[model samples]
Target: MRASLIALVLALSAVPAHALPPPCSGGQVYEDRNGNATRDAGEPGLPGIKVSNGIDIAVTDAQGEYGLDYVDGRTLFIIKPAGYDLAVRPDGLPARWRNLQYHAGPALKHGGIPQRQPDCTHFGLRPQAAAATKGELDVLLFADSQTSSVKDVDYYWRDIVQPLVGKHGAVLGLTLGDVTNDDLSLYPEILRTTMSLQAPWLFIPGNHDLDFDAAGDEDSLRTFRHHLGPDTFAWEEEAATFIGLDDVIYQPGQTPSYFGGLREDQFAFLQAYLPTVRKDRLLVIGVHIPVYEPGARGFRPADRERLFAMLEDFPHVLLLSGHTHTQRHWYHDASTGWHGLQPLHEYNVGAACGAYWSGVKDAEGIPDTTMADGTPNGYARLRVRAGGAYALSWHPARGTDDSGIGLHVPRVLRKGAYPAWGVFANVYMGDAETRVEYRIDGGEWKPMKRVEQPDPRLLLENMRDDTADALRGYDRSPEAEASPHLWRGALPTDLPEGEHAVEVRAFDRWRGERSARTSYRLQVGEP
Candidate 1:
């Protein structure tokens, strides 16, 4: 994994500088025809390129010159236009944005996005092949990798990232938020680890990824901008436009310091920017917190309504959020201000940290890290087709691909003991619509009842942790929760005193059929 990651960095066409950008008073999206970072005389400005102040968007005129009215406390960025690639800095952060420092913001504890306040904001865009911009997108999504410690970071690499190194051919990638638990200083290592992917990536801010010392919400992400590019920005490909926003609102003295909501600046940007986005394309909005749902606390209702109103015009939009370790899919209806022709699909992705990286270690010295909801500590792959079509699949971090289902069965049962034992299937991505069935010894396939209960697999691990003479690992697995994706079937214990095969099959709406196998032994007592 280390070697491959190193090779990936060396393979990139160019790398960005480690430091953040200064104020871009004005700039042009000129073609870097000469290959120099600067605009030589022959290099012409590219017209129709879009730029923004995190509020209003401006398009480059025929001469490629563009400007926008300044909005205080927002970064300045150029939307990566089609047929052009962003000229990135050496640090691998997207070079499309210029840091706009207020200097008036409270003295942020984490040194809010450095207040260098330079004059020039001119940026160069490299010419890209037309073929590269017109194809489908296989994206890598790590909605949450909230590594709290050095050990956690190491575990992130081994448990979640290492296995999928070169196998996942994701052309684009982004981290939803909670990039780190609280150690903002770990940003550098996080960047290096992601650099192994060798893909242009985006990052948004989360509650945990906050500067607790900052006095106000506006300055909470000072540390984040100093490292990753913009907390709110957009990147467009042929099939879709990917927009990531810092949706967490911090309240200093509130019971919950932060809430799931958008800022006024974000609304301004979306209102201006959405018009330019082609209605035919897919719209993917990534944020740290799940968009406010009925009865969901902290997420402001008004903000969610306004957001839904803004998105009401688009038909092919998908909402991606992270924060909860559990995974779920919600179809937004009129009840939540979504009056679109079809219900809005919001996929609350599973966390890569998998319940804060808790649980016992596996043979590879990595934590089991299964989420309380039974989703494994892994990442997601989003495949978007040419005509605004997309499908999703969850890849577990541990290895053996057993149909995306984890089965728990007692190793031994009393022979013919009232036929009371049963099998539990943790279908990681299963939802209410999923159909699961189980069969024994190639007998008739019996329907498995959908059940909401703690995954017995994790329950056994919890028991092991509680009964261990000494410590099992750094910590025990999290207390199991009623998993939305779990299914149960009563196993017949009326078989002969021998091993019996149990096979469980699940029908995934998108990925089709998948199956897993386990066996149980019926033993008789000695007389």
Candidate 2:
């Protein structure tokens, strides 16, 4: 009788608790052989694909059946196994997740997710005809397309997106966050603009993308999720797995509504997800805020430490973020709780809408929204290869020259004067260890000293803004700030009277040599 009772108890427990608001659920990940997005008869299930409840993960069984426990107002999304892709939804995003919660909460300022449910529990994936099986793929990286107004959106389109409509050979594209500058209404147009690029574009939420009316972090991105798929999601490529996480924790009544950190749910997701990541392939994580806090804990230390611990096992990992309106590369070591064999690299990607689109206009009517470090508002490309190797390169939205580096040479220098004035090369993607050299008048290439000084190019613009009788453009360029990727080489004022050609070359570790040229004229005397 006891054995029978125990068996009955087991069977009872096996049945999902319908009493819970969110009942336990089961679904199958299947190959859509007919491409109908429906599980027709005779369709085969794909095994071992991971499904998640935004916190916990469950792998499909041999027959591709998976189950998850009840979680109130939770959405279930699949981990998008390599070589297979989720079908695009009507909204033009990958349909990897299904929202379990059918009703909307209190009305929100940004119009939180609607009341209707769109997707069913079952996920359908199609095998790629031309998948990147060789473990080599290029990803386009964009951040802070923080369009505030329609004009700004047009600017983003013309400057950032229009040029690359069909120009790229990228397999995927990822925007770090801040899709809009607090205006949630523009989400549709933004998605449409991005999808035109013809790649599986992914996005995460930024602080600016928050629904401030929401009570806490959990509800902060409701509108965002409704439009941009899951704020935290994982995509599998042949060479790596790209994880997009919403790390902005919202504090309801705080001075700053959100801060950079991971919540328990996000931590839970990471803990459950990281173990499944392949150690041999590269792991690219995209978040809005940078991991390192330049100020008084811009990012929570405890959270970073915990995340570092979780990621230490991965031999190769790359963190990409874009909150800061500038570009920089950070290497985390023992000081940052990263004890990995090699230092961890975090590329704090520059803003796509550089400096909040607050700069003078260029010739094309696009704002020359150069970053504080003088990096022209642009996007970056990440080239990932097999065996955990990757290269990064930045592309200026409008480039007058092919060289990635920008040069600032004095128009005229007095003859026989001290060569105090030097040519400043703002290597937009340069690091402190980058080898930068400059040659004058086709002379021998001389090493340039790396300096943490403002780029002269922007300094000149600052002077222009400061001295202008009236507002120059829609807005003035940002004040010059110290740049970490700048190099300086003193030009020879003694060079006779003719204009001397000045060429600056930066030996990039990844994309190799990039050189820019300018000229300085020698005059009789200084004004």
Candidate 3:
């Protein structure tokens, strides 16, 4: 495995950086007319060449210079038209994606002031551990390290993941799924880069990482299994029994779609296997798509039921998964009077490819898609204790200047039934006595009413869904599951609206007084 990874990077070293063609204006197209990126003598720009900014698309000018207003630090790249090459930086950043400080792009700043790079890193993992030890370990989860070309792999390292070398305390690493985009051949380079983190790494199957040329799902993961050991297996560490499942269900001609189930024999194997394992030990279920996600693109209800039935009786279970390119936390409580098992502690770790690698880049050149609960491209470091209790910490791959201080925004606001501007804020900190406040448009801060005697477990669990399963994509209504501990109040009606700010600050378990502020830009009606 190590040798393959080394070979992959060595191969990528051969791709050379090309100069960019001169910038073109709207209504024209530019090409490597001289077979070079630079616009040379007699190289005429082509009109009608399309340039895009994710949502908006425009054409280039006859002079080959195109202009469209853009967020400077945000990721900007041509869609890479067929038969044309994009100019790449020395480190391999696509020519259009320049001005990045580090690979993850640039940081966000407002009004000539650097804004809060949310500490998306560092959340509390379960199976509480007071200290780090050999037996107690945390797994670094990565999803879809897919690169289209060898040079693209260099971009991932130079721009995205190369910063994790000699990271302080992570024990093992696991790539959740999609190790490659479509080139199963590129797995070596991806693995080699990750292995540079100096930890034992494991790989899982994503749809793209599968062998489409194979006849069926069973054979699809054959190459993957050979590269990363058994497709379905378990490892027993001191804290928990980590079970890896080959849940990549493939359909013929569908390419990368989930439409199958665990083989009958694997189901039987797990049934027999679970009996041999200690029931008291915590079971960390690692899979790709979550069993219960808020989108239609997740698991089927029946599939979840089957998996739940398998471990329904087991206590101290935490399901760890990442497929949805978003961050969410859900917990189950038997005492909460909720129906069904509630799939306790359903955490959807945002992808390393945050928002499918979308969003604006930062000064460091990485996208902010991996923001806290909607932050930047990052990875979670879980610390599992001796008793199976753990805490989670997020590390922004591109944000921090190696400080490892990620954003900690326990408060998120949602507009309620008042004016279009009326808002309610949900605060999620570990402290029970922490005071919370909100201010709009630099107005006076107002104290929020707090309800005492709330269940911490239930409080944390309820935050995942504040609406019905239909609306919030959960099994219950948000009102029913709403925790009174999370402050909810109306916005002042007298205040005029334009661009307002909502900030929530509280002392958490770690950071004494952490806050998350969001800008709300509203337009008022004509008087």
Q: Rank the candidates by lDDT, best first.
A: 2, 1, 3
lDDT of each: 0.82, 0.86, 0.51
Give the Å error, residue 339, model 3.
Answer: 9.0
Best by lDDT: 2
Of 1 and 3, the candidate ranking higher by lDDT: 1
Query: For model 1, where is the 10-residue window of minimal lDDT?
Result: 13-22
Candidate 1 local lDDT, 28-92, one digit each (tens): 88888755568888888888888887777888898888876644456788788656677767777
Decide which is better by lDDT, 1 or 2: 2
Best by the TM-score measure: 2
Off by over 4 Å in 2: 1-24, 117-120
lDDT of 3 by residue, 1-527 (tens): 99999998987676543222222222234454433455456656655444443224444566655565533222222322322334433322223322111122222111111222211111011121334334467778776566666755765685556776665457567777766676766766776766667654656576666666665555566456434544455545566676666666776576335542455545654675565555655677777766664334445556666666777767667777776554556664443222344446755665676544433344655433432232345676676666657666555555453222222222322323234233334343222454766676667878755543332333333464443253332122112233323553355434444555666655443345556666554444443
Q: Candidate 3, residue 79: CA error in Å? A: 44
Off by over 4 Å in 1: 1-24, 34-36, 71-73, 102-105, 292-297, 525-527
Q: What is the lDDT of residue 491 in candidate 3?
A: 57
364-438: candidate 2 lDDT, tens digit per residue: 787788999989888999999999999999998854555889888889878998889999899988998899999
Alpha-carbon TM-score of each model against the true structure: 0.91, 0.93, 0.55
